[model samples]
Target: MRDGGETVTFDFAPMVDIVLLLLIFFFLTSSLGARQTALPLDLPRASSAVKESPALPIVSVDPAGKVYLNGEATPLTSLGARLRPLAQASGGVVGLRADENGQYGTVVEVMDVIRRAGGTRLALGTRLPAASGATP
Candidate 1:
């Protein structure tokens, strides 16, 4: 014997628990993205490679000819100003990352700007290709 006025209710506790679990899972699994500017460029391969030192500041040059300093896009004229403090703070070493498709002239220009900015030590970023049959 059921009353005509009776209403049914749905339980959302389980659903909320599942949702929270999924949120936690994703939060734990998601990578902390690289701390660098979004420079869409493929780096050139190298035969001799070395591990990157974390202490150095990075400069990126994208294929579109945009320059990034410490993961932020900055004007060429202001590059020296931007880098001067960093150079003094970091003792003058600035790492350079340039795309393979990017023009050499652009890289040179960026290097020139860095030099004028008082950057003394510069390191070019590179990745070692898969080992070929040829011996080193």
Candidate 2:
């Protein structure tokens, strides 16, 4: 052997464990926030929809006419009481994310509820269409 040097090995088990724990922690915590966009709703496409603040409260309407507050299912009757404080805090600005195929009447009713809940301004959620700068 021509003056060979000793080889050293690294034990990556602890680092890997820490990385896995961090990953799980982040995943669990991230889901705890307002997840209006987390739903599988097919949003209507728009040519001009800008990003808004995340702190703005969100009201979601699924295809089945069910209502949700920040990703948690809520009934229509109690939506006002629940949304009042958030609306006031956000200066009456609330975001609405409704499924594109959802009933129009239901969406309108939900909007009414949001308005009555002290939300003076509505920020409707929409996505850009596949065709660049095209409206859907």
Candidate 3:
């Protein structure tokens, strides 16, 4: 070695492999969030409602009393028939997200229908009211 110069060495193969492994790890570990319904329902606000970490399957009941499962409108009479198969397939809880302005009787009716359809587990979706003087 005559004049000493800095040796240039670059190997990105290991870095690339590490990155790919990390990506795969994240993809495999991340929880799949709950599926949403197609129909939009303005849920009632609550001062104490807590947000669930993972979203739940939402069945929307509009002000007009129309029922929607996973966003597709289903007739009240056929609600149980339609929901049973979905519940069986998902092995997950079914839930209702109804407009606050909507009638309570309608929500009860929907619950009754769901129960009759063999949906044993159900949840209600709501968001907590913003704290006073806090930015939303």
Compared with the true structure, all predictions reach lDDT values of 0.80, 0.88, 0.73
Write the candidate numbers in order of decreasing lDDT. 2, 1, 3
Q: Point out where model 2 deviates above 4 Å.
A: 1-37, 129-136
Candidate 3 lDDT at 36 equals 60
Evaluation by lDDT, superior candidate among 1 and 2: 2
Model 1, residue 3: distance off in Å is 75
> Across residues 16-71, which tens digit of lDDT does each residue of candidate 3 receive?
99999999888777745455634556666666676653444457888888888877
lDDT of 3 at 53: 35
TM-score, candidate number 3: 0.64
**Largest lDDT belongs to which candidate?**
2
Per-residue lDDT of 1-136 in model 2, one digit per residue for the tens?
2357757678999999999999999999888866544878888877677886788998989899999898888999999999999999999999999999998998999999999999999999997556555444
Q: Which structure is stronger by TM-score: 2 or 3?
A: 2
Instruction: Point out the higher-scoring one by TM-score: 1 or 2.
Output: 2
